[model samples]
Target: MAHKLRLTRKHQVALTETAHRNLKRFCDESGLSPDHALTFLFENASSVFHEETLPHRLRAFKAALAAQET
Candidate 1:
């Protein structure tokens, strides 16, 4: 159910090691390649904002990145 896009747009993003690992895990669980997974998630990202734990999870992830920068 992933990777149905034509892929006309290309965006490059940098991820921390933790994020890279998390993405790999998510793609493995969902049976998606990284490109397809990114496409699917970008398209569906709006839905994530409605999750009950979204704020907490976002803060936790950001805090890790912030800590690394300091």
Candidate 2:
């Protein structure tokens, strides 16, 4: 059985208008609600931290930048 988690804390973040618009556009393009997108991102980051070695993470960052440039 899975343990239940409670929502006990919320944090507010401020985004520039351009960033806010971009987030909305990306969510629309991906067919994701903002909350779902955020949850997915958080879960993926947790998995990466759990399984990645320092060198692997560094290499991953380099790969991400290289992909962005193309």
Candidate 3:
């Protein structure tokens, strides 16, 4: 049987109005709750960092730029 994963940690972040609006827009477009979206991003980052061929640092920078464009 597969167990559902749960995140119990809490974090507080400060965002500018524009950043918050962008995050909200991304959440709306992807149909994900803010918590889930953050979880997904962290999971994706983990995978990216584990890759061998591409430098993890470069990939992370690219991902950040892509996220900003959304």
TM-score of each model, in listed order: 0.64, 0.43, 0.55
In model 1, which range of ten residues has the least summed lDDT? Answer: 1-10
- Candidates sorted by TM-score, best first: 1, 3, 2
Supply candidate 1's per-residue lDDT for 69.
100
Q: What lDDT tens digits, residue by residue, belong to model 2 across residues 2-60?
A: 96654445667688798689778879988987666565567687564546486787899
Task: Report the number of clashing residue pairs per model.
Answer: 0, 0, 0
Best by lDDT: 1
Task: Please give, for residues 6-64, the per-residue lDDT of candidate 3 as tens digits.
Answer: 98887897887997897799799999988877787777976734577558767897999
Runs off by more than 4 Å, candidate 1:
1-4, 50-70
lDDT for each candidate structure: 0.87, 0.72, 0.81
lDDT of 3 at 66: 100
- Stretch of 10 with least lDDT, candidate 2: 3-12
| Pairs of residues clashing in candidate 3 | none
Q: Report the C-alpha lDDT of model 1 over 6-64, residue by residue, as the tens digit.
A: 87887898997988999899999999999889988888988845778888988998999
Q: What TM value does model 1 have?
A: 0.64
TM-score of 3: 0.55
